[model samples]
Target: MASKSVTLAEQSPQPPKRLKGKKGAKTEARTTQIGLFTVEEPEPFKKATPAVHISAKNKALTLVQHKIYNALLANAIEQDRDHAGTNVGLSQFSIALTDLVDKVGLNSNNRDYLKGVINSLIGTVVNWDFLEAERGEVWAATGLLSTAEMDRSTLTYEFSAKIRDFLVHPQMYATIDMRIVRAFKRAAALVLWENSVRYEGIGQSAVIAIEKLRQLFLGQEGAKTIYPEYKEFKRNVLTPAVREANEVSDHTIEVLEVRQGRAVVGVRFTVARKQEAPRLESVDSDLLMSVTQLGIPSSEARKTLGRHSESDVRNALDYVRAREAKKGATPITNVPAYFRKALAEKWMAPEKSSGTKKAAAAPGLSITGITEEEIREKYRASQLGDARAYFDELSAADQAELIVRYNAWQPMQKWRLESGKKQSAAAQQSFLSWLAHETWGEPSTEDLFKFVIKGLASTATA
Candidate 1:
């Protein structure tokens, strides 16, 4: 037999769709049989894989606590030092307090009053500094002033004198309520450590304490003014008795009701009768259709669908299995061959068509300015949802171009996503929107717009 070559028409290219404005005609509405997978609820709290034990809960809360602690500490230090045009070394401030107490005479009434003032002022400074130090060594080392910039004389005299003045000034110290401020600082740092211990592990708790203490002195605190490391330790580290007392307090959950933007969704829980943990319940039919229209992942759709019932989807799977067993008709398990062919043809057809024919198919839409590489990059940055949205927005030619680019770029996007170099689906949209506004002249491509959107889609994805 002569050597024969064969082509698969089912795998071959087909024509792309062009955008068509609706004519003034009406047609009967159609109904779709959404797959049962659409009805299945996804467990939001469920572990990503079968092997995992715990849900990724309390992570966002712990992170917020850590960030808030660091921010408050830095703010406290800035308030104290920024007015002086340079940081008053914590060491110099401590020496000034010690000197003030001694000068005021320990046994005298003046000494007692001065001691109170000195203690309160030092307490404020130490509490704030301790907080910054505990957050991380990076903050402590670089917080107040540069290590290379330190001069002993400038710190001892000029810096110490300002702190002394602030300490003795009764009116100013009273106005700031230095003690209450320091207490807040302590609360912030301890909250983070406590949260880490409670949710993460005891090992993390112990490590946090040690790291915080270490960071406060040699790292963030030491970097400021070479203050006696004792000051940071005194404020941060718990004595054996204090540690024992802290353990008693730790068992009780402290729910700080902060106004987080997205997490709260119109549910309230009281101490007496806690509400069941909220998950997606029964989705309205319209919402389900919209979700299907968007082509949401089956897992996500199932999760949303599951939210409707008292029994969680995981718990209900056995019942579902039983129900299916009783039913004679089986579920739809395969995409129709024709539908699959149509899907394949939608993307593959571009390869067979000339570039001019592809562009000419959609009138008044510009593909002349867009490069293949640019389209590939944007498509790579885009999520499946984003690609869908982009598809919906494009004219026939633009959609054709997208089909061509996505077909080419899917492999590259898959690799980047798998490697953890790229952000999630939601982040990609925000980044692209921001990059479009900042780098490009406009938000979206408009037919008669003056400026072409400079392609920053790669940088957005990055």
Candidate 2:
């Protein structure tokens, strides 16, 4: 035994190889399944105000209301798909209350809080109007979760058939990340996010009329009484929502105000996908994809975007895209140079003033020997002339009605200013609409505002 040393092969046994499956046997492969979520009838649903519960009270949907409604829609769609052979528009389904709570991330322990949310969902009404075959059709429906009953820990619910059809077989829909929705703390932010997703691939900023934006935020009701002043609305609603969306959502949105004279009449939101951490292998490839999206040459976009963060580069691309989308935005003659400048300078928003300093310097007192006050006088005269021209365009009836409405609104304006209260955009629109209908027989709100501005300018000059 001492003379014969053990060989290494005799001391150890090799582990058995993983048994290969029989030929033709099913084998698992590494795969990633991306979940696709459906939105209820795409366009109308995206644009339709989820302002339930407060339409009667002139209020919009609260954050909780929005969350619950979306949760129901998502859950219904998922359940219908999960059960094999189930009808696509099946109205009835059962979900655990706990599951609903968890999905919505509701933290309250009180059962009634949940009950209140459910009741509100049952009472919420959503209206859809869309174009089909070049013809406009309207569908009015109430109660997102129209029917429901809770037994012990489980809840049974039914969605209206109209809603079910829209959700199950959506003709127009946007794929959304539910995680992003869950992260939004404000309803306006969520609405904006969804709208952005809906219009993601269009290569243009989504233009929402100021009035429509109001409705989207406050529902029909809340839009009426809240944030009467544009400044107040911007401070309280638009700015905050946009900031939150930029911080938390998958897209970066920048707002552009479309103005008539000094008043903001509409807004354009430029949306672009936020760039993720660069993949070592695909950085250049990803850059090329962005170039394609931006409608720029691959070599150019890379040179421009390479120096900036992915987000900064995408934002610059979006800014250019938005300009291209505008009706008369000046075309860029030099694409590479423009991209370089835009990305380098981070031109997210349009310039507020152009060549003002140059114009002011052009009229220098040293050259003309004219005082600054004289320059101011000349500008005032020009403005006054423009105002008079606009005023001359108004019908006599409109002129007369303006005096009346201005007088009527004066007291209200004074009261609001004195009390430190704000007039909401809705109230302003209502006043303008009423004045226009009374005087001009149903002119547009924009026209009415123009008339009012001209009239007020004339009065100040007089």
Candidate 3:
């Protein structure tokens, strides 16, 4: 009998088409179509405690771990509507390991490294707290990924049902560039980025009490006694984080100290987008060389040049040099100070007339006997004495809270001193005004200052 002939269709079926890697290893199915979904923006307004708990506490996530967690959340949110219920945890999705590696901007050669990150993420346990009807509530859960498995070259994970609402259905969220998140090496900077991004359009300035900031960055179980010295804290934590954000991210941040008398109470940060790149001019090596010759440090000169236009620096340098050339002119005792003042004030030419000897000097600096340094020191001492008196008048808890605020503010003051800048009176008054409002309802600015320093002598005593 003739055997039935078998066709190719009746034999083995072909595998789905997949992109190939360098080694010809099969990757996930390639899709040329653009993805039409919005990354579920994280709700920045939600108390940062939960995010901090997940990101910083319980074995802080490595860069890869952070990226993977984010990637899962983004993918889950994109597929949320397609799944049933408000729970992203109920929705399961699979991402090709190769696709994920590419999306996170990682090298595909190190599959083992990616596996380790996945394992760590699966093993992490997060603890968080919530308020239920004015009562404290505690909740503990596993990492963001509830279940994860690897099949072939695909990574499959489900979002934690406990955090589903917080992750996807946020009341208010921040739309951050994942590219920026991937670029951050330090966890502190990423935390700060999230904190600041939420307040982006609300106002140019954002203020966070020191205690809250600590909780946000260090987590609930982190050391309370750490960063005891404000200077150490600034050097180790604040400056580096702020610098990274400003350098790589779209936002420009200026940290300001909020003082209550002589002690720093908090920080006020002004965030703004970087100005558009200005029209370029031919490099003025001559001006830079002149700035160095005029006793400005080369590093400082370079920074000044970068900040101001060459024409501006050149004009300022010319004015200063011309003044020095005058026969009777007092040689500029502080060349760096002069250059800084010139650049700051945009001084192009000498004043037409020396109406008064005092007028000839820079606005803040003095000509005859006193220096700006002396004036600032005197003002600082007075402010401190006033703050101390006000601090003493508060109740125990209030005083303790004020001390925490002071701890936060001290670093900022030290930063200003190290940078050769003085804290302005207006900034101090703003802090005092905020304090007064917090302490005893709202009061007029004059009333606030008067109450804080009432019955105290004006004399500054160490």
Error (Å) of candidate 1 at residue 136 is 15
Give the top-scoring candidate (TM-score): 2
Q: For candidate 3, what is the lDDT?
A: 0.51
Q: What would the C-alpha RMSD of candidate 3 be, to one decimal place?
A: 24.9
Q: Write the per-residue lDDT of candidate 1 for residues 115-230, one digit (tens) a residue.
A: 33323222222222233233462221111111111132211211233223323222111011111112222222333323322221111122223334333323333333322343
Residue 200 miss distance in model 2 (angstroms): 1.4
Error of 2 at 388 (Å): 67
Worst 10 residues of 2 by lDDT: 34-43
What shift in Å separates residue 450 of candidate 2 from its native position after superposition? 68
Report the lDDT tens digits of candidate 3 across residue range 92-208.
777777757655555353555666677777776555431111135455555656778887788888767677666654444444445556667666676666566544432233455
Query: Compared with the true structure, what per-residue lDDT tens digits does model 2 show for residues 1-462?
Result: 121112101111222332343421212221222111011111012212222211322345666776666677666655554453544446688777766665555544245566766787777665443112113454454555778888767878887765566665455555454445667767667766666555444323445667667766666666676666777777777887788889976567778899989989888776555553222233555555666454342223333445568877766777666766778777865544455456755666344224233112122233246554554444333344333343344432223223333433443442211111244554434444443333223222333344445656999999
